[model samples]
Target: MPVVIPAAELGEFVTALLNTKIPDPDHARTVSDVLLWAARRGVDSHGVARVPRYLELLDSGEANATPELSFSGGPSGVTVLDADRAPGPIALTAAADEAVRRAQAVGIGAVGVRRTVHTGAIGYYTSRIASQGLVGIAFVAGMPNMSYPGVTGAAVATSPLSIAVPTAGSSPVLLDMATAGIALGKIAQYRNAGKTLPEGVAATADGTPTTDPALAKMPLPLGGAKGAGMSLVFELITSVLVGAPIVSSFHSDDPQGRVHRQNALILALDPAAFGDPAAFTEHVSETLAALQGLPSTGEIRYPGQNSAAIASKRAAEGIPVGPKVWGELEVAAEKLGVAVPVTPGG
Candidate 1:
């Protein structure tokens, strides 16, 4: 069974850990926000559950607390960022800002990023760009996971793709999805619990299908051939285009034999390029309203709607954490000796 923790306590504990271990305030803030938002949005796998790995990587020198980010502006509204081997939050934000700037200038901005760490939560970046009154689309890649297109075994990264549009009169539509049948994080959670997974979702190391979490190593594509095709195309948009430092050695060198760290591509567009921003947003709002109005045969959920609703409820109540993760955070807090926040981050 999973554990449950109060939200405020978790946030405070995480803040103390990040501030204690990572000296950079912005990096700490960004990481904290991502973790907190994950919990608030009910994505437990990504919430405080990630802290142990973050600390492990930080201690192991795989992720640096402070990485200097720099950029080169190019023709055709392009920006190339050298992450200087920094953590993802810093690099991703810098890229999003640059994309917004270029889009503002040219009605569109596209950036290719290299040498960054795990950015965590691609929606965070796209939503940031969208909030600035621009339409944004993004793709990010981690080390390779699963096989490619009936290939069964490893071929390319999981290839997560995201698109966010600025709504003039309503909330922007943000669609961020993994080509995998389910999030790899979900598999990890199941494995931790020694549970079985939903059928047809994963394969073993040998690439045969398996529902037993213990035997599962990778998730299959969501819709088989269609899923594989989308992931294949995403690889072209993310890793290859950005020059994935992938070598035969890169795979073996990584613990998972996929992502050594993280790689990403960000594309931003100004709605002004298409037409009036207000009008565009109004149309989106109307369409979404109509869709939501349709009678749900079951528990119908919109892409980002659940997150917004959960945030509202959790804010009034508290963020819930599993007991295992809370215990881990407690130990880290004791080590750092920093006061945890009075309220959890949610």
Candidate 2:
């Protein structure tokens, strides 16, 4: 079904399609950026693959393209944002900026976002905040997804935690990972690609293991009990702390999107908050160099290493999106009265 269009055509096609359902041009652009960046990087799971679902959510009332967000002050270092059922990325843009600023003042900043739809990669925010030469850590907690090891049905959400530090290299040691072995986003990506997942990524509803993508009824916690325990703690700091609450009942994703909430705790610590900034940077660099200098069993990756390389390669060659996704993108573009892409670059 892939209608091969060039990259430019694809972008225009996607832009036009989003514009049709989402009247907010700015939010549409933000969504575009998130999708594009995911593809440009190596995360095919979170990349442009989600366009169809996003469009469907917009066509329905599940995800409101235009939402009026409100912000209120809490603790001096805390800000609570009520998304009023808006897209997650749009609401986060402002909240992230405010958190970094608070970090500038009190050596830490925290923002809680509630009543928003799915937010993309956690690393995106931490990386942005780290460019200010501060150590940035983000905790993204959501609703119940996977179950406790050896249990069935949904029990816990795949709470993701990410961290980033500033460095001169093209890619910093940015680490973004879910507490689970695999994330819900990645499962959806596999479904879209019509491919089976690997064993250990997920399990069937009966607690038995399966690699069938269609049987991915639950997300498995990473490192077993340890990951599950961390997710619970983050759920408290994120959703529970914000007063929105987190449980299996609150977690529902249908064509008619439910009233979901998100909590993001961004902590920024200035190097000066501890000791000399230069010394800290030098120490980190030395450690990284030592790690890289060691003989590698395979590839010595320092977090975010894979993504930076993927982005560089995609920028040069072109992103390798599924042919089916490409076809639908073209069809959507044609429907929107936009030009089709000649290649995937657009």
For residues 1-346, what per-residue lDDT tens digits would candidate 1 score against the true structure?
Answer: 3344456666666766887667887678778777787788777777788887778777777777767777875796997888876667778878898999999998999988887777777777888899998878888766667666657476555667778876655456778788888777888888877788999989887678899888888888878877777776766766667766543334466554444666678988888888987787888777887887899887755577778688778877777666567667767777778664443332
Per-residue alpha-carbon lDDT of model 2 for 1-346, expressed as tens digits? 3333334444555667777877888778777666776777778677777887787777776677888888886777888888776766676666677778888888778888777767777777777777878887888777677777655676777888989987644467788889988877778768877788877868877766677778788878888898889998888887777777766345555432234556667677777678887788778878888898998788687888789887777777666767767677767777767665565344
Error of 2 at 118 (Å): 0.6
Best by TM-score: 1
lDDT of candidate model 1 versus the reference: 0.75
- TM-score against truth, every candidate: 0.89, 0.88
How many residue pairs collide in each prediction? 13, 13
Q: RMSD per prediction, one decimal?
A: 3.3, 3.4
Using lDDT as the measure, the top candidate is 1
For candidate 1, report its TM-score.
0.89
RMSD of 1: 3.3
